[model samples]
Target: EEPYVAVVYSDYLHLVCSSCFHEDAPLLIRKCKEAPLEACKGCHEVYYCGSACQQNDWKIHEAECKFLSTAVAVPSDIVRMIARLLIRRKRGDHDTFRAYNGRKFDDLMDHRSDFENMGANFDKVFNDTKNYVSIDYMVDREEIVRYVGKLLVNQFAIRGPVDTCIGNGLYIGICIFDHSCQPDLTRRSIGSKMILRSQNREQTLNKNLTVSYISPLACTEERRKLLRSNPFFFHCKCRKCEDTEQDGYARSIKCESCEGGICLVKDDSAPLRCMKCGITSSITHEEANKWNADVAIVEYFGSEDCALFIRKSMHIFSPPNMRDLAKKQS
Candidate 1:
């Protein structure tokens, strides 16, 4: 008796489970020899050898089942071409199984004119802002070209079944969102299904708001640098990035004399007047000069070292319990 087999189509080939081929003719036809006649109970599109094999593969297949079910049957010619591409990559000296990064395969073939227009529009937007934007003129053009080409190729090769089942749906309008150092939105993926949600305190999204896809750990300067360098072509003037003068350091400072909050400037000449208490005390010119020198020395020691020193300094000046509370807040 031969071992039972299970076969399914994905990416560029019909995947067959090597150990699952069985001797029973009808069972073989229903399981490994071709597309499964009986779909998995939960996601009724995937075929398995039996209840046992389905149970075993459930963990891996559950997430992808919905996506797989929605894929339209590829034409025999297209499937063959894709299979050849995969085989050539396996046999060739160079790596050819590169992932596609651009438009969907179905979309690219059906909407070539739309993509060309989009590309032209993107270029026009970039060119219009040349005066205000300080773009990195020496970016590697080859990398951009390669990325775009891969995207187009992938778009043509991978046609989702949902294309036919689902109506002629418009593409998700996410291009307008400019990059931000601290984005308000977060994205979650369950298998191939993507869900976007608000991560910030706001309950409702405002008009003209754009969603972000990047992590928000980056500081303002790093975010701006990315925006300037990327194909997105827009300098982020978001509130967090633009308000450099009000960085986290200024919010952390507390007055030693009255325990009142004080906002300090980078230069450390005289602390800004406290809004809570109307008193403004001026640091003498000598003291200001010394403070600037100290800041330079602290910065030279590196940020992590400087932060540790500041924590120790705070502990020396403040109550022990207060230091614990500050650490907790941080």
Candidate 2:
């Protein structure tokens, strides 16, 4: 709990109480004053649940208040956390750099080679952050870029009481686990701190544990792609990815030749192979394009919203296509 660093809630994310980092904050804004929620005299963009929280947070908030007051465009979320860390470090808060389980900032992997390997896109993001969020305190631009790189891979996107994301933080302690398609540990947020527990209650008999960073229901390809793209820039050799494409096959259509066989394809360009009868099926450009667009919308929405989105998509796809997808999800 001592290591839990609560970030300043951004109005951009509709968060309440920059101190406690609660969500749906605007709903509580009106009554916050008489309810004794204090607004910052500097920039009313943020608020506090009480004076104690305001006082405890001000050490880190001073620079952000100054930055927010002057800037026309708000800094991105990553920059704000980095700014807080920097401010805390300047204030002699050693805990700011110390990660959970006795790990230091230097201990986390920076992915320097990975960023360099990304080439053009890396330069674009790096340059954009520097140009947009460069503060006067850090004279060297490379320092900020380094912090950004470490954070991109190491930071956790914090969730609130609502499923919506409220802020981002670097949990030095929780960063110890490696990736597994079927993780042994799961996490839930309670106020500012995240609580982690063994997926199997009996499994906790052994203290050492691991957790999966991504959703297990995801196919091997989706899991690998997610791991490789962001901070953890490596291919996953987890049991699920190593075993079979059954999950991918489950989500895919039946083979055209052998309607009983599941059709398995690595990507849009690859031909779908029949798991039972071994039929290789080719997908048209139009079919692939529409399938991707529909998948994106379906995955992004909540359960209630997903059904409505799928219902809307029914107008675009053929009945046969919808029936196949319905079977896949089931």
Best candidate according to lDDT: 2
- TM-score, every prediction: 0.30, 0.66
Local accuracy of candidate 2 as per-residue lDDT tens digits, 179-267: 68656666555545666766355664232566667655555666788988867888888766886654444345545665456555344
Candidate 1 lDDT over 158-271, as tens digits, reads: 112211111011122232234454454433321122334563445465435555533333344555665554234457887756776543242223443466444343333445
Which consecutive 10 residues in model 2 have the weakest lDDT in total?
A: 25-34
Rate residue 278 of model 1 by lDDT: 46
| lDDT measured at residue 57 in model 1 versus the true structure, 0 to 100 | 52
Q: Give the top-scoring candidate (TM-score).
A: 2
Q: What is the alpha-carbon lDDT for the whole of candidate 1?
A: 0.35
Clashes of 2: 2
List all candidate RMSDs to the true structure. Answer: 19.0, 6.8
